[model samples]
Target: MTNSTPLLEINDLSLSFTSYAQGLRQISTQVLKNLSLKLHAGEVFTIVGSSGSGKSLLAETILDILPKNAHVTGSIKLDGAPATCAALRKMRGRELLYVPQGVTNLDPLMKVGHQVCLRPEQKQYQEAAFKRLELSDAVTKLYPFELSGGMARRTLVSTALLGTPRIVIADEPTPGMTLDQARETLQLFRDMADKGAGVIVITHDLTLALEISDTIGVFYDGTIIEQAQKSQFTGLGEQLKQPFTRALWCALPQNEFSTPKHTGAAGHATSSASTASQPESKRAEANSQVIAGNEPENAHDAAATQASEHTGGAGDATSSASPASQPESAPAKDAAQHAAQHASVLEAKNVSFCYPGSKHCVLENINLEVHEGEIVGLFGGSGHGKSTLARVLAGQLPIKQGSITFDGQALNPHSCSPVQLIFQHPELALNPRWRMKRTLQEAWDVPQSLLDKAGIRDEWKERYPFELSGGELQRFCVVRALAPTTKILLCDEISTMLDAITQAHIWHLLLDHAKEHSMGMLVISHSEALLNRICTRVISIDALNNHANCIEDQ
Candidate 1:
């Protein structure tokens, strides 16, 4: 049923960006190198890779939306003919639909319904799309900022599904969605492929990709290292050809969940084989010690054990027990250890919140607490009050009633907040006009060591938020939140955009820092596997709020 000739094809495609160096000298960095792929009608092709691997950039290149400074050397063909910028522009919305990664792509000034419908004639189609996605009719009137991360993602999908397109490129489209919602979205993509449309999904969630992708391209560094049928990704990934691809398969939480030592600079999988062949006992020990989330003991007790190991005895500032290769200064270590003895608490007591002009309370009587040295996971269904609560706790939104306190005091709005919020959409959280360096410096004078630990490169500092991939921009956001003054960290789907390796790496870095500095964290995400791996304990938003009751009554 699939077409013999590809619907979209790329030949020897390469992309690079031009940026300034220390002086006025300009340098070009090739982020995407010799990438090539084909999408056939009636098939779903997925590109899986690490963060900053240029998967999203390929979509931008196809849409001809890359910035002016970008230099591209590639031939993009559609229906066996060249796809020039003008031709692509002509067919952009109707023939070549795109579901972008950033929810910021939605116009902040417009209502959701207007953005999706565009014209009065499209209202019916928009309604149908919303219904199919399980979005309430009321959501149509809300602005982009009013919607939760999951709702915003579904809205973007609705926009793409409104038109009959020859090709659909969705970039990390299902991150904030619930499991059912994510599966439904993928099923929609499959249905589109069955209807003779070529669908390309770029994602970090390999488990979801395996469920729907017909063909999978393993992306690394900048290019496609290997291409294999979905069936080939099997036990131990023996049927897979490339080491990195095999590593990715084995790294899934359902699989071995083994972390590779390192993915080499040249896109080689040097340590994947060893990781896949790790002994069961050794792997279990590593997982238990690193994540510390699966222990049957009390969550706080488990955290205490991890802290003791990470800090090498309580109140021992001179102890060389840090998990990071680069240790903190002696005075900083002394202060952190002293603070650990009397941990601060971030608490919300009988809190309630409702969006302005809305009759229903999104969060009602929500009581939650995160203690220093604790990583608490918050789980909830899409469009629920999870993000709303996070906003209130971070002081981004004022609570309608009750109180939120840190260390037994009210949050001060006049000065720099002790709490920092890392948003789900990195693009929206950042300034599009400023370079990456200025963005980080805007919060604090972030050390070079912290940037390196977060996988940010020096060359990237010169680029703007729009120039970097979503995952790459996310690193800057994470680093910005880790300022010295920050006490409580609120993460809203922070790792959803990253690959398995990068996700683990970031979590590992954060866990180490939090445990060492006695900082409390509230991590909000849809990945239960991730929560079980990193969090001390997972709590459902329904358990802490009356929003579910309000919905049932409705």
Candidate 2:
């Protein structure tokens, strides 16, 4: 802990949105619960949690950028003074600065240089920041639409870092960059903290965050359930007190690869101490299947048993298929024999693609195959054409050089698509005007079973895209893509925005459903660890793109 006073302090801050449903009925849904934290000068404080755990919402609330209908409560103090909406207006871009998640935050018409040079004198510092981030000087002359996804992300980050603010809040800042680049970018935040500025980073990559964050706060169900030193998350998570925290630690592919299950209720720490002694009946209590909204006979008891595997171990990140718990196994889902015998369901033969107007092709000579019951991981650095390949395979974009075949036939554009693509941003994929149920219904006739499997609540049907959390909306996206007609699931960085617990739950649900349905999948991601943990055989897209720039797993 540093001796410096907190530059930003949040005490029991809660936020909710007010909206009207149907014709004229008013509805208010609470999205954030009593969340509190303090960011001291010269410290990097990171908030870790699931997709809908209010991490981004927390940032929006702090910056006072939440939707107009959003209602906020509790005290928010900045520089030891009340940080009400009025006070925040004065500090929005000067004392307090925000770095949004994507380039969409960039003004489309504004020149990049103009965007970064909020103050004329800051241009030199901005250029320095851009160089540190490995950005080109020419990039400053382009418009928002002119830059690639990776370039846009770097611009957003550079724009934020150009300002010398007292406080910085960056949300999911490393999604589109390579591991080394992400590490370097985060180190800049740490350096800013070293210079007596407060930094708060919201991201899904806890492994990298551990290297820089001074303290970590675990957010779940719209609140912070646990907070601890960054040093506590090490060596099987023994020093960590929260069960979920330990579960997150173990869920990393480098760890035990087990994700602990939870009842989805707020409160309670996952204790190996309590679980080391629980009987089979108690452990059964742990597997009560909260993803389907089934609470155990004893909620607390379930938490202990479910998270107990981490008592002296790791990687219990929702360990549902382990023989120790779920003894029954499906023969067709077994990877050893089933995957070998299952017929090839989807194949891309020398597939290559380029954007409609661009002269250069992003992907070339990409040959990939997936059989029924096979989960293929496609991993690489951002801008390496992973997502472009997914688009081609899913028939969203036409292949320029090669052919894609599914179920021994060419894809039909008019009929129901055999390949379903789940994008990284669920909200963008969904219709802001339509309700969740309607969007899901367009893909499947009876979506109830799919909803239950994907852990989407019934109440979410009435909610619009903006009303739901990214994780919740993502659940809907998964259900829509895994419809009966889908032969191949193209998941393009789908869970990159989610937290560890939600990431595990989503993966568990997906793996279970895919195995049962014999649905083949191509999982596109930047995190090699995530692919290593969930995929049967991870393949590098670099093998297809023929690019010599990115590092990958074979």
Candidate 3:
């Protein structure tokens, strides 16, 4: 551990938000329960958790942004001084800087350079110099309206850094950034730590967090259930050593092991030991289900029984999936034909859209297409209208020029449906006061059979948005969108807020759903790996922006 004074400390902190309903006063909804942490100067700390785990509330409460009726308890100290909510508010933009998820954190109407130069005296930059750094000498003069996703992400980050805060709290800093951008931003944070600033990144991305975090804290059920060094978090056999942490440990990419100095070959040995601990029957079942489409329960039952028998023995299960365990099946010919037939479900021909307040077009002459049976990935620097494109495709926004067609039907600028856009943060999109059923019903006219088929049974109807997990709510939104019609889906940074494991699970579920419905989807993502795994073709909005630079890799 580094020998440094704690820059910020939270002691027994708790927070509750207000929930109001008919004929009743506001009811307190507890979010954080006695959360505590101490961050030293020149160090990086990450808080990892699932959605609705109160991780966000902790950050908000630290910034004193909890709702008016919300209750806060416990003491917050900054640089050894007693910190109060009033002090926190007064010191904002100086002592602490916050970068919220999505580029929307920056006001759309303001110029990117103007937003960054909010504290001209503190920033000590001439208007011209700032523009050059922000690449806004051209774009900054234009408004948030004209930037791309990468540009917007960079601008927001520059603004936060320009504030020169002692402690930076970033929520999903790399959510919608490409791999290179994500790596660059994390390196920037590492540089910040080197410069004697304390940085805290609150994210659900286990892989990114493991790659960057000096220390990791696991939050669950409104509590930090585990805290350990980065080595301890991902070291070999680390999972078997801590069964409670195993699920999370294995969920991340296996390549994130510490260097030889930390674990040496011991790490590999430990991983092997964990693998050897699994029963042969279970391994066979898992392989059969993946390669043969066997029932999950049947596979799990056989595996579990074998695992129980080999509970204390080390066995090699890699060879368990022998020929005998394989299902006797032929290739899926009709499935291939079905997938091919559903191709080109959504098409955008030279699509251009402009917001009411902006004089310049937000999305300039863009052409894109989504085929059935695969995810079409959208890539562009921020503010170039990735979300706007999603909205236009979903028929939520009207295009100033160009056309969008769904299933061979031309979509009028005024009337477009059959496409649904799931936002980066669905919780904000949902009405907190309404139950799931009311919200879904309001969005779609669902038949009884379809409702049952969607996996949203009667029990979930009464549950409000706040009652469901982030993944569940996101899935619910997709189901609701599909309820109206199931031709195509438009997802805009949908998994940006989810943890890696949950994000993976959601994507798998989406693929299954798409296959089941024989539908097409246009998915907007910053992660190239995700696109590579799911999309048939990757379209760059950057290339679209500069048509002369268009280059196809296929």
C-alpha RMSD values across all candidates: 6.4, 9.8, 11.0
Q: Choose 2 or 3, whichever is better by TM-score.
A: 2
Better of 2 and 3 by lDDT: 2
**What is the per-residue lDDT of model 2 for residues 45-150, given as tens digits with 9 covering 90 to 100?**
9888766667888989888888789899998888788887788898888878898875457888898888888788897889898889877777777777555455
Candidate 3 TM-score, C-alpha based: 0.72
Cα lDDT tens digits, model 3, 1-554, are 35665899888988776766567765666767888889987878988865557776677777877557778888889987888767888778877888765454678788665777766584454343334333445555656645555565566666565645689888766665666666777767777777878989887766677677788887766867777676775454354344334545544423221111121111111222122222233433343343232345654444323212221111212343322233423344334444455455687888777667655666677877666554556766545567767877877788888888877888655643666677765665789899988887787776665444333446557678766655557656766776535667788878767654445445544654665665667778766545534543456666566532211110
Put down candidate 1 lDDT per residue, 1-554, tens digits, no spaces: 34587889999999998777687788888988888888999889999987778888889999999888899998999988999878999999999999998888899999888899998878888988888898888787778887778888999999878878989999988988988899998888988988989999998888888898898888988999998988898898999988878877876655655556664542222221222232232212333433333434444544444432223311122433323223457676666456555678788998888777667788888888877776777877887777778889999898889999999999999999988999888888888899988888899999987876777887688788877778888888999999878888999999888887667557666766775676778889887666655555567787677443332122
Report RMSD for candidate 1: 6.4
User: lDDT of model 3 at residue 330?
Assistant: 36
Please give the distance, in angstroms, between residue 74's alpha carbon in candidate 3 and its true position after superposition. Answer: 2.8
Give candidate 2's TM-score. 0.81
